[model samples]
Target: MGGIGIMIAFFAGILGSLSASDYSQYTYVFCAVLVLTMIGFWDDRKDMRASHKLIGQLFAFFLVVVLGDIRIESFYGFLGIYALPISVSYALSIFMLVGLTNAYNLIDGLDGLAGTLGAISCGFLGVWFMYAGYAVEGIICLGMLGSLMAFLIYNWHPAKVFMGDTGSLPIGCFIAVFALLFIRENGEMHPSAVYKFHAPITAGLSLMVICSYDTLRVFLRRIRRGKSPFTPDKSHVHHFLMRMGHGHDQVAMFLGAIKLLFLGMVIMCSGLNEHLMFPFVVGLTIAFGSLINVVTLKRMRAKVRKSPPISQRYPIKPTATIKSKSTWEDEPVLES
Candidate 1:
C-alpha cells in the first residue's frame, strides 16, 4: 500500500486542473510519471527483477525525453561546455532520470525521512515555479507537496505506511523532471528577469543534494570493497546518525535541515559561476559526511572498549531480518 494515498491525492488534483488553459502541454510528463508509478506498483507486489525494473524506468524516461522534448540541452558552461549534441542530450537526460529515480528510492530507509525531504524539495520548487511563471509545472509540484504532507501524517515515526518503490520512484522521477526543467527554463530567462538563477545547474543539484551525495558515497564504498554497488548494507547517512544514537524523527529533521542548509548556501552564493558553485557544494557535502562518519566510528570504538572481552562475552544472535533477492523490494539493498 505504498503511496496509494499519494497517488490518489496527486491524480485528483491533476484531474481538477485539467480544464486550465494550455495545460495539455504537460500531459506527457503526467503520463511518464504515471507509467513509472505503475511499474513501481507492480514491483512492490510481484517483486520485479532489477533488470526488468531498469528497462521499465528507461522506457518511461525515454518517452519523456524523446516524445515530450524535456531534457538537459546544455551543461550551463560546466567544464567550459555549453550546448550538447542531440545524442548526448538524450543519453544524459535518460541516465539522470533513471539514476535519480533509484537514488531517491535508496534513501527511503527511516520513517518520515523520504516523505519529509520530498515535501521540502517540492515545496521549494513549487513556489519557484509559480513565481517564475511555470503554472503547470508549479501545480504539479504543489500537487506532490500536498500528497506528501498528507502522507507524512501516517508516515512519521512509527509509520503506518511506507512509500516503498511505488511512491519514491515516481516522486524521484517527477523531481528530476522539474530539476531539468528548472535548469533549462532559468537559463533561457531574460537577463532582466528577477527570478532567474545565475547558477541554474548548481541550484538544481542543491535541491537533490542529500540523496545524490549519499548514493554516490555508498556506491563508491561498495566498489572499493570489491562488492556489487547494489549490495545491501547499513552505510547510509541515516544509518550513521542512528549509530550515533539519534532517534528516527531526529535523523529525519537533521537531514531536512542539511537540505535547507545546502539551499541557503546556493542562495548566498548566487553571484558565483556554476563551475565554482558546483565544486563548493560538492566539497561542503563531503566535509559534512566525513564529519558524521568520523563521529560514528569514534562512538562505536568507545562502546567496544567498554564492553566485556569477546572470549568472556555470550554469543549474540543476529537480529537482522532476511531480505528478498529483489533489490528494489529489499529493505537494505540499494535500488539504484
Candidate 2:
C-alpha cells in the first residue's frame, strides 16, 4: 500500500537521523499512521461505525499534536489574527484536522480519485516545504508524494487495487500535517520561498480547493435534506461529474487537472498581497460551489427526464365501464 511505503520511509528517517529540523520524529508519525490504518482496515473488513472511525481519527490528531508537536500556533495574521491561546489552538487544530481527514476520505470513492489528487497536493506542498528550508517536513511530503504516484498505477480506471481506508486515512493525515505546517509562520520566510506564497494559508486552500469545497458542499446538502452529515451517498463532486457523462478515469483526470491549475495559480499569485490573494481564493471557492450546485440541478433534471412517466411505470387501467366488450377487460388486474 502507498501508506505502507511512506511508513517505511519515515522509519528509515528515524533510524538514520537523516532529517533536518528534527524531522526525525517520523517515528511518532509512523505510529500514528499505523493506528489510523488499523482502524481503516477494520472498517474495510467490518464496516466500522462512523463514531468509532471519528474517534480513531481524533486519536491520530491528538498523537500528532501532543507527541509530534504539530499544532496550530498562529493563523499567519489572516484578518489580523495573531497567536491563539493554547486551549483554543488545540481545539481549533484538532477540529480542522479531523474535518479535513474525513474530507479526504470522503473523496476517495472513484478509481484514482484520491491517489491522483493526493500526489498533486502533497507534491506541491513538498516542493514548497523544501523551498522554504523545511527539509524534514518536505521529505515527509515527498514520501507521501512518491507513494501516491506509485499507487495511481494500480488505482487508475479499472483499478487493480484499491486504497480503501488503508490508504485514505493516512493520506488525509499527511495533508492535514503538511497544510497546517504550510500555514505556520516559522519566524521569517526564506528569500527564494517568499515569492512562492503571498499568504501561506492561501496556498493551503488552493492545494485542496476541490476536496475541501466538495466536502462542504456535500455536508450542507445532507443537512439541508434533514440527513446526517455523515450519511454516505453518491452526491460527491465525482458523482456529479459522472452524471455529466464522464467515466472514472476521465472524472479523476478532470478534477485533478483543475486542482493542479488552481495550485499553479496559487504559486503565481504568491507574489501578490495576502489581502488580494485571500479574496481571490475565497471568490474562487464560492464560484466552484455555485457551479457544482447548478451542475447538480442539471443532473437531477436530466435524470427525471430519463425516467419513465408514472402512468407508464404503473400501467394505469382503463375504466371498467368502457372495457366490458374486450375479452381482457372484464376483470381488474395489475400489470407486472
Candidate 3:
C-alpha cells in the first residue's frame, strides 16, 4: 500500500518537473536518488543484506556529491572550523551526506515517524529557502513536504500502509541535501548576518536532532554489544517506547513532540547566542534521551515485579469434592 503511494509521489515530482520544464541542480536530487529508492524498494520486498543497501546509498550520495556538485564547501566557523582544504571538505561532505541519509532511514521504525519528522524538517527548510530567495530550493522543499504530508494521511499510526524504503530513502536524501545547502548558503552571507540572526550549522543539526542523535546512540549501543553496527535489532527509540507499552500512535506522538520542541529551541537560541546553542541543545537532547532509557528500565523492572506470576495467571482451579454415601463404601463425587 505504501509502495504504491510512494511511487505516485516519485512520479508526481518527476512529472511536475517535466511539466514546468524545470531542469536545475536540485531537480537532479530526485533523479540521483533513483538507485537508493530502487534498492530500498528491493530490500523491502526481498529483505536485501545490509551491506548491499549501504553500497547503494553510497552510490546515491556519489551521484549528488560528484556530479550534481552539491557538496558542502565550508563549516562557517562552527567549532571555529572553516576554510577547509578543497580535498578535505569534499571528503567530509561525502561522509556526512551518506551518514545523514542512513540516519534518516533508521528513524523509519514506526508509522508516521519518517513522514511526520521529514515533513517538519523540509517544511522549515522550505521556508528558509524562500527567505533566502532561492526559488528552486523552495520548490524542492515544498514538493517533498507535500508528498510526505500526503503520505502521512495513510502512514499515520494505526497506519493504513507504510512509506517503507521508497519513501524514507528519498526523505533522507532530500534532508541531507537541504542541510548542506542551508550551511553553504550561510557561508555566502556576511559573517555578522549569521552571528546576529542564526547559526546555520547548529540550526540544521537541530532540524534533525532525532535522526542524527538516535543514529549515533544506536551505533554506539551496537558497538558495545559486540555486534555489527548495521545489525538490525529492537533497540531503536521507537522500540524503546514500544517496550514501555506505548501504542503505535502514542509513540508517533511522543517523537513528533520532541522533534517540534528541538526545532523550536534551535531556531530560538541560535539567534541569541550561536556559539553556545548547539552544544546546549545537544546536551539537553542527550540528557532527555538517557533519562528516558533509565526510566524505561526502571519501570520495566517494576512492572515485572507487579505483574501476576505465570502460574497464578493461568492457575489450575481446584475441583470441589462432594461426600457421597453408598452401600459398599463412601464414594467421592466431583462437584461442578
lDDT-based ranking = 1, 3, 2
Model 1, position 296, has a per-residue lDDT of: 90
All candidates' lDDT scores? 0.88, 0.78, 0.78
Candidate 2 lDDT, tens digit per residue, 1-336?
Answer: 444554565456544645444655556666777888888778888998888988888888888887777778876667787788988888988888887887898899899999888899888877877877777777777767776777788889898888888778877877877787777733236536553465777776676788788899899999999999888899888998888778999989988888988887877777765678888888887887688769878987988899999989899786444433473466566333
Model 2 Cα RMSD, 1 decimal: 5.6
lDDT of 1 by residue, 246-274 (tens): 89999999999999998887878776778
Off by over 4 Å in 2: 1-23, 185-196, 299-336
Residue ranges of candidate 3 with Cα displaced over 4 Å = 1-4, 10-22, 191-197, 272-274, 314-336
| Best TM-score among the predictions, by candidate number | 1
The list of candidate 1 runs beyond 4 A from truth reads 18-21, 308-336
Count of backbone clashes, every candidate in sequence: 0, 0, 0
- What are the RMSDs of all candidates, in order? 9.4, 5.6, 6.5
